[model samples]
Target: MNMNRTVLYKAALPIVMVLICAPYKVNAYNIEDAIKAVQLNNNGIKASKENVNIAKTERAQAYTTLLPSINLSNANTRTTYDVPQVLPNSSSGDRRSTSLEVYQALFEGGASLFRIDAAKHHLKAVQSDHQSQVQEIVFKAMEAYERLVVIKTVYDFHVKNEEAMQQHLNGVEARFKVGEATVTEVAQARASFEIAKANKNVSSGEITALEASYESITGEKAPQNMDPVDISGVYIPSSLDELMQICLKDNASIVALSSSIESARGNTRVAYSGLAPKVIGAINVNATNIKRNSPYKQDGTTYMIKVNMPLFNQGGIEYVKIKEAKHRERKQKAALESQKSAIISAAVGIWTKYSSSHSTIASMAEAVKASEIALKGTIEESKVGTKTITDVLEAETKHLDTKIKHTQAIQEQLLAVFQMHQIMGTNLSMFTNTRPIVQTAFNKS
Candidate 1:
């Protein structure tokens, strides 16, 4: 019993130690699950959310500026003079003073109101940017998912092709033993088998890398049997004009840049307001307490109206900012134009790719069928000595290549459809059957 216990402990110890040291395994994620996890956990999305919060607070602060301002202050001092101060007759054990001041802005040449507007616009821009970031992350997750699925499918075919080549090699060797096949034929078959093995090994390595990439993006391991998204039945725009119209309303980049332009215009108005004087209403109350001899007193409240004019601060102050704001507005407008151009270009490119992939897939499908039939016929002929061993092997390799190309065409078509959806700024919520993952931006009345 002691010996048996020792053996079991030895066997279990490594497993226990490994479990303790190994990295914690995350749960598997499907497409929708992966996007949700990213929204919750991705570091970039986290930072972008923080930016939205900052924008929200800044906008609130802008609104606060339109309200009254109040301040409270106090001061205390203890002094002991070797000789009693005579002129003012002030000899203090402790002198305490408190003041309350209020400054209400009656007017600021509309700069404050414009600043508030600018802050609000900036907030909107950042919110839109955050949404764009979410979409980008979703697109990346989808790409990773597709890559892993397609590559795995490719890997499976390579494995089967390798097996087929191995069988062919064995047949060729048997024929050579019977003097029915030449040594060169056997050598060729062996070489083809090795090449297929190398291809399978290479694809295996690709699968490992793709799996890691998928995990890194989704924050979890992918499931073994991933149901690939079939975008074929998804909506496709009828024409480029329809796509352009949708893009005009839905593209996040254009929306963000347009908001930025409005913000810049507001800031420009604010900068020009510096040329006018600011009217402020102010009041202050003073309360002071001296020693027991003096007691405490409350001074009368002082009320005053103050006007502050911007004198001069060279060219570095409001003047430069006004000019800079104008230039910035122009720059942003140019950027928006450029972005629209790029969006159109991308939409056209994807549409073309998807359109072509349809025919490419059909053609490749036919090629695969013909090659399969040719391989079978060639194999029969080779067994009957009417065809050389080399012809049969060549036909088999051609069939495998044709089938791989057909699969690749299918993958491209699917990805093109997904790409079209992404480029058109389709709501990310559409990716799931459940509730939407992203909020749709609404136009204000």
Candidate 2:
């Protein structure tokens, strides 16, 4: 029974120890925070939101064309008649009129229907534009957040290196007093320590600036030491063709450009409709009264229906020159194609950088392992006076340098990978725990 217990203890001890020494993990920033920091805070999103409201109001106005428009007016007039200038029963005539007139659209060569169609498309375009703004702000905020993490990591490493160099300088000074090291060695150590200090100061300043910029973008204080992503495994694209397809379908830039093109097309149709004839059926009731101070009065009322249509337009040349109507349509289509091409190019570049950075990180990892071994050997030899203080310092410097380089390479690789995912317009939920905010700006309309 004792032997069995011992075997069990031996088996579990290694596992327990590994668990205790594991690096502390942290939660990633959620997408909700990003949405609040970006979509809510961004000026572009605010403008787009207003545009959505305007589009909805415009659509409501267009619908009114199908209904009757009514107007009410009241007026009073008094005039003294000229002496017989023309059969003046214009007897110091006083007149008062009150009337209401209304018109209902019955038909107009399909123009009204086309206008309604155009308005609906215009509203859809506005909605798409608003979403585009939200996406853009989210992207910018994420980039700034990631950049801040990289800066903080690099700054922390520099601080550690400075402390390590200071310790080496102190040891070298002690050795010099003991006649084991020369003043020249002490001076060299001091100089290296100073340079390390300078580098640390520069890193600290850079971190401060980056933190400020990050705060500005988020409209909130930057979180301390956010957990950096631990990316592993090389990305192997299925094929370039697949990537192209993804961009064509999911790229927000292209989607926005296409929306613009559709909106422009609708506007062009509306402009051309102006050349067509318009007709409306109408009925109006009106009454006028003429009064005399001696208590005489005259009154009349009338009811009528009327229709009006355009016969000729002298403005055809000007209408044809409304370049905006056509240019906007063509420009948006061209821009959509250009955006797709640019996204494809960017994805290819990011993938290549990810590949190169992956290899660099691997090579630096090996270098760090070698340096660690060398550092250990030099420290063991230093106690026996075989390894001089300068030699130990050199080995320490090289080891620290390799460690920093390795960390940097890791950071670059993670950023490149994220960038590639960004280009593909992957869902934010994949990397974050929170979801995007609900947009209800046009819910009522």
Candidate 3:
């Protein structure tokens, strides 16, 4: 008992240590997060995993095609009538006998090898498809994450503007009550205030919708006050050709298509592999008892070996080869077309936006600077009775518009960067490299 206890303890110690030493980690699973959740949880991936298991089982089954098969039989007979012998009348004798038979495959038309190879190729195809599905999910997550970030930033901007406008309105209302301001100015301030509030509501709704989509993909609630990405320092490709090259090399769709082409080629190999002859050998043992309706007695044993060759298959094999070849051709063509389309679309969209947004940003920055100077001049002139209250209000409004536009320009640039990244799969590494700020926030408690 003591020895058994010691053995059990020794057996369990390693398992306990392994469990304790495992890594404890969590991720925000945002746009930057690895899209493992989607792949790990997606129904498609589950099916792919099952297909891999099925392939293994099929390989085992294929091996059995060469193994020997056995059969056993026993029978008892009793004669009730006499039979005539060669010399005179004679009685028939009762007899009981048991026979064992075995058959083994000695050769085949390479059917087993073809079956195994086909199953293996299918397994590889499913694995490639699983990887493709993973890439697709990651792209989707990136899209959702970026949309949420855009909405949050825009909403915050509107909320800040609303607060500032509310304060200005309050001040203007007090001045009007003291006969220091016109009713028209007060009404104008009120109108601007209402517009800001409406914009804030709309932006907030957009944020909520984006948040819901993010959560649905991740199966987790998002953190509050999630900060937008800081892509100000991201490198932009210089030209359309440069962008196209990167996308061709990195795009998930392109990668998936490439993998599929390989898989189709593998299928073609499997189909043609059937043309080769198969050789196999097997041993079998069969036993039977010479007892009537009894399971207690020992029996005789027999062994056998056999071989089979296919001369004609009624065109079944030929049909399969032709079908596989055609399917492979179709897959190859489809992959080529898909890669071409993705590259062209990414190149045009990113290049056009990259150029336009850069110009817009420069122009917006200048406009904001000019608006600042104009607002200051208008305020000075109004104090000296050279400008009316309307002129000052108009200047302030223009400055605000320019500031907002500049913010929008920055947003457009960030969005453009994300779009470029989507075209290039390597951009996902940015999310992988950057640690979420919320990690420390949560750890502090």
Candidate 4:
């Protein structure tokens, strides 16, 4: 008897362990917390922020051209002289000198001035780029979050459907045993259960794939049973014209491109400044020992300013540099226009999706309801020998299809709202609480 009991215990242990662990496995992460965590931890976003900081440092350096460059020098030399033994004692002679020099560029044609402007503009562009990164990372998290939700919903639905298919197959098999259902009906019911089992497996696989994506963004295991997203603040503009205008004024990509153009123009001016005359001023202060044996010292100060003009370039290098900058400016201008066009197209596409998803969700909701009622009626009628097993299975399949479609529509609607925010360049606000220290986009300013 003890041996029999041990065998039973060993047979049941795996199932018991699975039961104990399953309930504790799911972790539900808050969406806001995930967004904040990604912002703080994501490596790419951190790198872009560093780029902004670098731009700020360059801006300060650009201002240094307006300041003088100072140099300090000190030199000490010692010489030892040995007298003959009959003569006096050996002596050491030392000489010390100190000098300070300052050189100030009173003028750099206008290169320094243009560089200062270029630095600020480039900083502005970098700031825009940083904001864009913040938006992108947040959107990735949101996308993964929403997709996980949809996958979980569908996965749960498939689980339930599979259970129902199993029950139906059991009932048909029992009826075949009682000689009430044909062998063909039993086979058909068993075939439907196998398909349902396959569907459940597919949904389970999708849930796992989505969880991996979710973890990659938020660095956490996906939380199950996420509450529906609350997009109460999302809205579409009344007309395409309004959206286009808003995008033109506020989109970060366009803002960055505009800043790049301004920076390129400043660079061109800096190159032009190289061809202009320059003025420089210098001052020198020197102190030196008058003699090695004497304790006297001499100190003198000199000051001078000079004007310099460039007569020619050896290989037209300066002119070519200006031309290169101008070409970059043109490219930036063209890119800005292209970005605007793309934004307009995206707005139209999202609007269409958002509008269509509204209809689809509603239509699918009704279809699911109708299919559920039909399924119930078909099952009842089949039990009375009126509806075939095939009819009942078809209705079950239709119901499941409608339910999955409805969930997909919901996912699309959610993503479309986010896409609208992305298009309008307001997505950063949705994820981050702290505003930028310096506003880059003119519209935001």
Candidate No. with top lDDT: 4
Q: Which stretches in model 2 have alpha-carbon errors above 4 Å?
A: 1-35, 79-94, 107-109, 230-240, 292-314, 321-324, 426-445
lDDT of 4 at 223: 70
Model 3 has an lDDT value of: 0.65
The residue pairs found clashing in candidate 3 are 106-306, 110-278
Whole-model Cα lDDT of every candidate shown, in order: 0.82, 0.70, 0.65, 0.82
lDDT, model 4: 0.82
Task: State each candidate's clash count.
Answer: 0, 0, 2, 1
lDDT of 3 by residue, 145-231 (tens): 666766666677778778867876887799899997799989888887898899889988887787787767655555654445665
Model 2 error, position 438 (Å):
19
Cα error, residue 167 of model 4, in Å, equals: 0.6
By TM-score, how accurate is candidate 2?
0.78
Q: How close is candidate 3 to the true structure, as a TM-score?
A: 0.68
Query: How many Å off is the CA of 360 in candidate 1?
Result: 1.2
Q: Which regions of candidate 1 fall more than 4 Å away from where they truly are?
A: 1-29, 77-95, 289-298, 314-316, 433-445
- Candidate 3's C-alpha runs over 4 A off are 1-125, 232-239, 272-282, 291-317, 388-397, 427-445
Per-residue error (Å), model 3, residue 297: 11
Top TM-score prediction, candidate number: 4
